[model samples]
Target: MNEYPIEYYQFFIKFNEGDYYTCHDLLEDMWMEDKSNLFLKGLLQMSVAIYHYSYGNVKGTRLMMKVAHEYLQPYRPKQWGLDLESVIAYIEHCISIIPDDIDKVSFSKIEELPALPTLFLYLEDD
Candidate 1:
């Protein structure tokens, strides 16, 4: 098994705490160090997408979710204790609910959207 860095775990902590912005910050440096690391890039994009959704920016949320999905698709099943398949499914679900005509949706209406379920990262042994 490959050992992951501290930031990798910290990203999950922030994510589960509903601190999506912090999740992005936790992984940004690692992603920067290895631009080819699709996992890290995908995680960063995922954090950004959730952050945008929290702020009721439907357009930004949809855009970021699409990019995150693209980066994460190749890692289906699992990677470094993360379940890419489940994550991708969740992203697709979020994308499906976002309206294509983004401009017409008010922030109040966006707030009414269902709250995303908490994401959990399981240990490899589990």
Candidate 2:
């Protein structure tokens, strides 16, 4: 088997540990410098978009998601359909979360979610 660079593991660590932005940033470097892994590249872009969406960065989310879609367009999503759809929903939800009268106060009024929103997703995202 072939090995990828340390940067890949670094990105994975950050992603698994929930340092969303950091993982996203590291993945960008790998995506740009490594030409041998198109699938990995697409996955990383999707991860970045999801990370950005997790932080309410709508534009960043859309940009990366679009890139991911383009890259993966040649393949059949059936293999990773659920994960792919999940990411797409996450990106869209971030955009939808905004409303003309989105009161942060509304969120505050709500009790804690059943699960704390996941900050970092690992191999799945990266």
Candidate 3:
């Protein structure tokens, strides 16, 4: 397997720590450096979407999830040892739980949202 970029590893470090916002910052900078990298952009959007969900920003959450799904879907199965399929599946799972109407979900309802697993756990071991 090809080695992942240092930024990619660092992104996971922040993401696995429940620091999705930081993950978004880190990956967004990296993605900016390589705008042609669809995978990086997808991961960046996923991070931001998760961060939005944590803060109960339902609109932002759905918007970013849609961006992430659109960008990541074409690079499925795996990418640079990361299991994109599993990552996409996790994103889909998150999207599935969102209320049809954001207004229907209160703060307590947001609190009741399921805790998502770390995407690092789905990484393929070299």
Question: In terms of lDDT, which candidate is strongest?
Answer: 1
Instruction: Sort by TM-score, best first.
Output: 1, 3, 2
- CA RMSD of each candidate after superposition: 2.2, 6.4, 2.5
Q: What are the per-residue Cα lDDT tens digits for candidate 2 across 1-126? A: 335578776765776676766866776677677666555566677677655545445466556666766665554342222244544454455435433242222335434212223434333322
In candidate 1, residue 114 scores what lDDT? 62
Model 1 residue 8 lDDT score:
85
Please give the ranking of all candidate structures by lDDT, highest first, separated by commas.
Answer: 1, 3, 2
Which runs in model 2 stand beyond 4 Å of their true positions?
35-38, 73-126
Put down candidate 1 lDDT per residue, 20-63, tens digits, no spaces: 89889888989888889998898899899888877677778888
What TM-score does structure 3 among the candidates reach? 0.84
Predicted structure 2: clash tally? 1
Model 2 residue pairs with clashes:
18-120
TM-score for each candidate, following the candidate numbering: 0.87, 0.50, 0.84
Q: The CA-based lDDT of model 3 is what?
A: 0.78
